[model samples]
Target: MQKLYSQGSRLDVSMPVIMGIVNTTPDSFSDGGDFFSTKHACDHADKLINAGAGIIDIGGESTRPGAALVTEEQELARVIPVIEYVSRHHDVWISIDTSKPAVMAAAIAAGAHMINDVRALTEPGALAMAAQLQVPVCLMHMQGQPQNMQANPEYENIIHDILTFFKARIAACIAAGISFDNLVLDPGFGFGKTLTHNYQILAQLAQFAVLDRPLLIGLSRKSMIGQLLNRDVEERLIGSVSAALIACQHGANIIRVHDVAETMDMLKVWQMTQTQMIKQN
Candidate 1:
């Protein structure tokens, strides 16, 4: 069994887990316009909790390719209330998905348990805020900003680039007084990689375990699956599940996903079969 993940609160990372995505955005490529209202967001959070989500990651901004950036005030307006509502109502762990330090601090003040920063806390002064808050933080690796990330994806060595990025970010977090166990790594599946780069990253995930941090793979209904199967966002459940299963098999500790029920069912069945297979072996 692996060790535990203390993202905000302590998570028994003895086994693979699923973290459900609750997008408060109006333009996310997947599950956008789905959980936009307070009532709807709260309802969706309940559904995800019932579906076996170990954590609920709420995001206000859309980091989708070429997605417009939301101002700090706008982002706070969008996510703080939702985080507050969930924190006040639910006993489940809450993850705030934001890159801005202002929003991160505000969310932390609102009782968010984790900070899932797409920039890996490289944004100046962000690491300090997270350290000050003393919360678990997820550092995601993206080649560039969201506005022009997909314009031209080029990399001499994708694995090397990702590792270097993680190393720098992890070092910064450590220097900022954040505990090592409280830090998580995200490969940024669809942040800025090409279709080929995305597949390559997913296929060779073991390379990332060198960083020795809990790995998070958020490929739920991402463009890589959409391109692979030529399916729309609504039609990519199986592909997303398959991708998540592959990621877990290749050493991913957590999977951030929109399709919580299906992913949870798959995880239950997969775990049971793994137990049987291990016994037979």
Candidate 2:
């Protein structure tokens, strides 16, 4: 059984946990303008909680490939209200998806329980700030900045490089006074990988488990699904859920997704099947 200790709360991750995506930005790759408003975002959070989401990941800025960056002020304005509303109204854990130290501090103050950074706290002062906040921090592996990451991303060996990056980041987090148990790892699918590269990581994802941290996977309706399946963002629900189930089978602990209800249903089926198999054996 896996458990993540957050600020004043505990998240049971023994089963595959769902971190529902709530992008409050207007330019998100999928469902961009759908929840850009605080009311819409908060309402969506309510729906996600009811649909069996273990965590609500609220992102103020769009980190989609080739996406423009927002100011700290803009990010704060976009997410704080929603975080506060969710925290006030729901019993669910809130994860702030940002790499800015200021945004991390502000989100936690406004009621965020975890930090899900695409840049993995590589920003100046981010590591120290995360240590200070002492919340469960998910360190992701991105090859380059979002704007140009997909332009011509390359790796000597994709899995080996990512493993190296995670090792270094884990060390850095612990050295900065962050508890080893308070860390999570993400492979950053589609952030800087080609279609082949993405599948390679997915096939070998269990290798990351050797790091001894909870593995957080975000493969929901990403371009990898769209491009591979030749489907649009709105039409990738089935593909997204399929990939998510594959990731869970490969030992993913936290499955970050946009379709909470569908994903939850699939997880229920998977869990029950596994249980029945164990009993039979």
Candidate 3:
């Protein structure tokens, strides 16, 4: 259960790791267009590291609701250069937020350390490629594609259904050659969940512990925070960090966020409290 993601050469996650979000696309829900340029993307990544992000999650595609798809060439064009640039320069762990096997392969060839596939390697040949590449893969549970997943999102039983999906995927990965140690799971908040379902999963997040894999929660400045606080993406930092703290307190091993410094600061305070409780105990 102890494995490092390629993003930071992070061989450990017994404590939480702050994964900084770097969207090279022009349309991500948060921090889009801010680092569309390669230099800007690398600069922002360095900033995140200085702010306490252990991993730099770079994505070229926009998975936000109703966002049109970018062609593979466009996607590759957007992400590969950034990946190559950072791989050569930074000592940080580099994760390519891609679903295409071709892109994943190319990114790996270019020196990407982890494959954070939103599709959970469900894309054709993606699982096999990841298995062959033998990198840590984070399986995300998305109810439907980004196109219309939110249209009528319904879960027979949110937690059970997500666990079932993860179980099957984990089996397939093992069958293909990925080890449990190299696997992580994310419930794909806001990817398809209703606001109610989102909180329900968070409330029951610890249930995933039974699977015995590292848990990754990405509630950073998402719609869940926005809808909960009636705030926009630009103003959801407090709610976002609060949700991250709750997830970490429960059982999350990793938090993917847009605000790395703030999350780390909050985690420091949280660590102090936990230490006090332990001493008192």
Highest-TM-score candidate: 2
Ranked by TM-score from best down, the candidates are 2, 3, 1
Identify the runs in model 2 with alpha carbons over 4 angstroms from their true place: none
Pairs in clash, predicted candidate 3: 4-10, 7-93, 7-94, 8-93
- Top candidate on lDDT is 2
Ranking by lDDT: 2, 3, 1
In angstroms, how far off is 263's CA in candidate 3?
0.6
Residue-level lDDT tens digits of model 3 in 84-168: 8777877777788989888888888888888888899899999889988888889999988999988989989999999999999
Collision pairs in model 2: none
User: Which has the better lDDT: candidate 1, or candidate 2?
Assistant: 2
**TM-score, cand. 3:** 0.96
- State the lDDT of candidate 1 residue by residue for 38-111, as single tens digits: 77888898899888888889899999988898788788877888888878877778899998888888888887
How high is each candidate's TM-score?
0.95, 0.98, 0.96
Judged by whole-model lDDT over C-alpha atoms, candidate 1 comes out at 0.86
- Every model's Cα RMSD, please? 1.6, 0.8, 1.6
Q: Where is model 3 more than 4 Å wrong at Cα?
A: 5-10
